[model samples]
Target: MEKNFTIASLEFCLSQLKRADESVVRKAITSGDGLSESSDDVGQKLSEAHKNAVKQCLTNADKLATLHNQIDACDKVFERLQNMLCSFQNNLGTIGEDMKQLQVQSLDIHQELENRQKVRNELSQFVDDIVVPQPMITTIMDADPNERGFIEALHELHHKINLISSRGNGEAVAVNDTIPILENLKYKAIEKVREWLLLKIYQFRKPLSNYQIFQHQLLKCRFFYEFVLNHEPAIARELQDEYIDTISKMFFTYFKAYASRLFKLTMKDAASKEDSVGAIDTAKSSGISGFFAAKPQVRNRATVFSIGQRNGVLQSDFLGALIVPHAAAQNNQSFQFETLFRSLQLAFVDHYSHEYLFITDFFLVSENEALEIHSKAMARAVSVLLKCCEEQIVVNWDAISLHLCICLCDKFQQLLIEREVPDVNGYWETMSNILWTRFDQVMTNHNDSVRMIDLKKLQNQGALDARPHFIVRRYAELTSAHLTIAKSNGKEIGPKVGALLESSEDAIEQLLTRMSTMQTSHKNKHVFLINNYDLILGVIDDNESKQSRIYAIVHELEQKSIDDFVEVVLDPHIGFLIKFVTECEGLINQGHTQLLVRYNDKISTVITTFNQKWKQSIDAIHSEVMNLFTNFRLGTSILQTIFTKFVQYVQRFSKIIAHEVFSSNSACSEMINVHQIMLEIKKYKPVY
Candidate 1:
């Protein structure tokens, strides 16, 4: 087939070459006729040659057709052979693949069989190790011995039954059918073993063979006795004397935990002579106190302490009292009391949730237990509370301290009310007095330090940031607490403490007012320390109230402090205030307009004064640009005085000017045209 394909390829190549040869002869005959006088004769000869060539081509065509036929035959054979070879190879490949799959399948089956055999062997070996009927309790009414092989055979059958049952394979139906027979065998074997053990147990009682001794020994194993007694408790009683009864009871308790059957068993059903009181007594005497002691807070926690309060103290006494407790506690000579106070505060938070701080509940507590709980819990938990507050709970010094104090006072009042605390001539008076005295001392100390205001330092800082912020926050919360009491609704808040609340509130207000005055005085003193210091003090001394007295000193001192060339102290306070006024353009315009309208005639007078005093500054008659921006602030102020002036300016500038009657006029507007345009301008201020 390969040789035939080669012959066909050669024949095809030769036929193509023959066609090329014929074309060359026909081309030569046609071109010579067009080129010469003898071209006609030359063409005739060429034509004859062409004819000859054509005759040759006829012969070549016959050969070509024959070759084509031959090549077709060869191609047909080659194609058939290729088809056969391909079919044969495809069959071989399929057979090879099938054989490979069969080999893999066979290997898998073989491995599966090997695993099965191995599992079976392991199972058989496991069966061989079984000891037949299990080690057991002594039995008493038979005389026989079980053969070792027979016993082992029964054990092996039991194990096989178990294995077959566990797997639950439908293919193991044969094994399933045999389970009843296997179980029967097991029962027979157990019966036989029982008879044998009974024989051994009785036969060896004289000298006590190993079996008899083993029965006695088995009683000592808690589990062995437990097992035997569980199956036959009445039977166990028949074997029992005093010691056996004790062992049997212990066994029952063990079985209660382990088997969970016959649990909480009792001989009380037999109606014992002893009473149950002794048992109750034993239970009560068990070490429960020590267990409670391990957890002091569980025992000690309570909601007990409380107070009564009132408020005519808003903005003053209320504020002071709020601060006094915390301030005094922080400054206390006894760390213990301070710490206890802190702890109670934290306890109130935890026990009551955050609701306690904002709400007043009756807070009913049990007995003195509540009081004692509070006392001890506070003691136990205070140091920890403070420590946690220090590490993880930072508060705003002023805001929180103040808020917390008010909350504390509120909680204390709630406690008092719940406890039905009595007023007048009693423990309440003593406690109140004690608290007041301590508060007074703390306030006195705080004022002494606070009164020596450092105005120079304050001047270096802004109002809100002038001091450690807590001082202000605490001051505010305390003041607010008294305010809260006065505003409180309902009859819960007591009236007895009303005066005290008012006094505290007044004190807080006075203190703040006093501090403000002193700071003002100090600022005055500092500003004029270079000169007239005595004069400044004298001026401040004339004013009674703090701020007034201090401001009197400051004003004079500031005026006197200016340098010779400067007409003012050159302080930048006004500059900042002015900037504040100007930053918002609409606001500036609004303010200027409002102020101008307020002092309409006054502003005109002031402007006139300025114009007269500084002739060069405002010398423009209407010919000039009006120079609105020379004094920027003044110009803004002027806009306020007469908003229409701006309208006129823009109206005048925005018009078309006419310099002649009949000629093209200037583009800019004439003054009369400006007046006309002014009427059209929107005069209303735009909404921001």
Candidate 2:
């Protein structure tokens, strides 16, 4: 019945329900017996009441049906919900067990964290204890902290600090917390080392006052530098400067006292040596040879503190010994030594204006008023100084040589140049000679070992490529300056240049001739003479190109030299033959017909003698001549020219005596005689 509750079926059910209610109302009205006043009214009221009761009963039944249907739907929904809740209950039990396990794990983690914290705290304490094993104050307070023990303690401290740092980012927070403490320890350790070093220096006792304390202080400084400062060069430099300052004060005091003592001792030794020399002179007056001979004397190192002490304490003196020669030595040690000595040199100049240091004396000419009066001592001193500057190591060449040159020139000006009756010619000549000598030495031997300065090397390495030519140009400048000065003074420079050229030519001629004579080769001797003579001629020809009077003289010299060489070499052979022909012509002109017959024999002998000598000379230089002249045609041309002259001379003689001296009718006449000599000459068959 309840399944018929669709919209159409419910409308039909509601229609039937309304009809039943109307039927019950009508029955109730019809059956009603008692009516209160009016029967119809009473019946109508009773009918209404019956209809109400019936409607109430019908409404209750409909409501009961709807409630029963709703209760059954609710029962099915509750049954499905109970099945779903059963799975949830099982899951909840499992979740509750998991929650219990999580609580137990939380407790275990909390306990482990506490244990780790305890371990970390213990480690922190241990690190703190190990980072500084010995109290720094104790070490600082000690009079002399054992260096080994102190270093070990510091090593341990640094090691522990490094270990803590090595814990890395995990312990970065911890390490940062401990950094200040570690830095404080390092600071205290460095301070202690400094204090200890100072104490050792203060306690240093040296009876013999010398540079020995400086060496001791250096050792301590190195210790402070490497051990305390480590790689902190800034701190090390500060300490080093302080130490050097203290030592410099000490050194100056000792140096002044030592200098004073050395001066007195040197004066005493000089006096005693003079007395000893006088005694030796008296003892050795045996002969002139003995008197002139040099005496061999032993030098006492202690007595001699002045110059020439090349092997004594003065050689490795305290001031000089302080210098250490190396790349870095220039900065600290060498700088200090230079500063000290520079001050000393200045002070010496102030105190001893007249007295010169040995090096200064060697380089600078002394102010001698007597040199104008022809004093021998001043000349000897000048010679000695020149020799010393050249040979001794006491003078620095680069620094002192320039000063020495200026001093020499100034002294020359004073004594010779500025004189009232100065020998201007002699002065200019001497100065010019000096310039020439200097130039010649350098030009000839600029590459020799004695030249310590290598301009070629300098040019190769220097920034400017022209550095090597500077010295060469400097010589030219000096020469020009001297020449100009001489010209201004109206001195006779022409004679000097002429003399130099003559001397040079003489030297060249002597050398070439000597070389020619010394040539032992039998063949090509003339060729060898030609090669040597030509080489010299080429040099003189080059010199001639320079438009100077000197070169002009050399050009004249060159011509004379060549003419002389050619005469010496070539004349002996052909000159004699030419002379023979000329003499024969002279005889013909004088009407010596008898002599013409004998002339063939005499001329033949002369030609034979000249040919032998000429052949010998040619043999001497044959190989050299062949090597020297690369052009065979040129050599042939030269030979042709020489022999053609001889041929022409012979031909001229033939023409002169042809018709007069010989005829076909004459038996054993001069023409037949001359023909025999000509045949002998033709046998030579000169190739050129």
| Model 2 C-alpha lDDT per residue in residues 1-688, reported as the tens digit of each score | 5666677777975686587678755775587744334448756998999999999978799888899999999999999999899989999999999999999999999999999999999888756744444454355335244455566566655566566656653455556666666667667767776665555444423445443444445353443445455534566555544543444344344434433332222122221322210011123335677667665343442221111221121112322322223323334222221122323322322222221221122212234421232222123323332333233212221111221232233333443333332332233244334444543343223222212343234334341221112222222222233233233333434554435334434443443344344344423334444443343333323222344553454446434543443444345556665676777778877988777765644544554565455445444333333344554643443444444454466566556545444433232233234444345445444454
lDDT of 1 by residue, 346-447 (tens): 333333222121111111234453443333323323333334333211221121122233434455455556545321123223333434444444333333
Highest lDDT model number? 2
lDDT of 2: 0.43
Locate the minimum summed-lDDT window of 10 residues in model 2.
273-282
* lDDT (Cα, 0-100) at 341 in candidate 1: 35
TM-score for candidate 2? 0.28
Best by TM-score: 2
